[model samples]
Target: MRRRFVIEAVMVATYGHLLVPSRPIDYVVPYSTILELYDMRDGSDPVMDNADDDAHVRGKISELIAFFEDPLNRKKIEKAMQMPWRESSPLLLSDEIQFTVVHAVDNASYGEFFDPIETELLLTGSKLNVPLLSDQFEFQDRLIEAEVPVQVYDIEDFEFAVEEGISTVDAGLRGE
Candidate 1:
């Protein structure tokens, strides 16, 4: 069965609709998802558990809505959208992926390394190579690459005017 994942990549945010027919809900992607992608490219399973979208992405969506709805952070958000690692989308997995988590290795007792996230773009069977923010982690300086693409989805893909803006109340997780 196909699994859902979040890949944090540097991508431009699109609204009102997507090119794909599957993505129907509003969601957000964090910066850590890319590490899983890197691991996947390196022939590692990264995670064996199902890690679909969750509260964190929703929280980010809420934050984005609140930030943009105010008409104050609009420009800043818009600019951030264009920059890499600023915006993200969910990735549709092809039976091989199953993950979504913050890039952390605080499990010193476990002795592990953590790092990237991506769910912003989707191009199944297609490979992707992105620059890493090496400074974020100690070992990242050595691992700076990503590959393969999955189904991509935008958080807000419904018709909404910039002036109209989406309110946290109106743009609820369920779009209720």
Candidate 2:
């Protein structure tokens, strides 16, 4: 039997939707190897075991959403967070040079703000030696749908949207 895992990450980059001044973010990728990815559990609190790393990622996602509260200053914050990192190159050198894009949002309405960024990342991936040729490509098409309680953020008057359930994945995790 094939075991599945859900992973969530935060990223900041420029695209059609963002106002401007956003920077390419730097995130420490977890589950680097396929073996590590396969070992994750689907219990109520997957990240609770790795509190430090998970907390940092959640904080960044909150900060990113908060930045949206002020459209004028959005780009400035993104630019400040941008750091230089080695990105995949055009040459088909080796597997290490390839990359795939995984999308994540701290809140429910991800399709709103994330679509443009996802498009930009897809274009970038097209130039690399990655294996994301089709939307159904294994490993590349793993979409982890999750929901954190609305109280996770300091913002008030929040609304949540839910995606249609799929027969494959289970996302019944409780949040405090």
Candidate 3:
């Protein structure tokens, strides 16, 4: 089972770009309207933005959002993060791509609930060397040892991303 706790880090980050905050609706609030509802087009404040191009950002992010939000899909992704993904089925990164890691990340919010998720993914999936694209290099040594070839991954031709080897991860989250 996944554990939860208070995170002490001054700031936190999570991999992937489809996670959005769930806004519970209250019919009693007469002032609220569907127009006021948050949309994925309004992206979050980035820790760093390295993407120069924005063409595929919306499509890719939306595709992932749908995958993660489904109940059966989320469970599979959680299992992948917990165990070597090859032991289970691969996830659909897109309609044509069935990757080993994918899911809804609602409870996987930063600070407390999801602090260890990526760490656990690296730890558990070390043996499989799954094709991963992550911001955190928590287990760089293991990833390298497994011959998984850790190079910078970016769709845009941003010089900073290439120079700094930081892949641009854009996620849509509802900000307060």
Q: Best lDDT goes to which candidate? A: 3
Compared with the true structure, all predictions reach lDDT values of 0.29, 0.26, 0.30
Identify the candidate with maximal TM-score: 3
Expressed as tens digits, the lDDT of each residue in 75-123 for candidate 2 is 4333423432233112111222111222212222444333433333332
| Clash pairs, model 2 backbone | 23-78
Off by over 4 Å in 1: 1-7, 10-31, 44-165, 172-176
Residue by residue across 1-176, what tens digits does model 1's lDDT show?
A: 22232334211111212223243322233433333333333443322243432333333344333433345333443444564444323232223322222222122221222221212222110122211111123232222233222222223422222123343245332221
N/CA/C clash count, model 2: 1
Residues 1-176, candidate 3, lDDT per residue (tens digit)?
11111111111112222122122111100001111112433456332355533334444444545654468756764564463222325434443223333221223322232244443343322222222233434444444554433232222222232234332132111110
Which residue pairs collide, candidate 3? 68-103, 68-104, 91-99
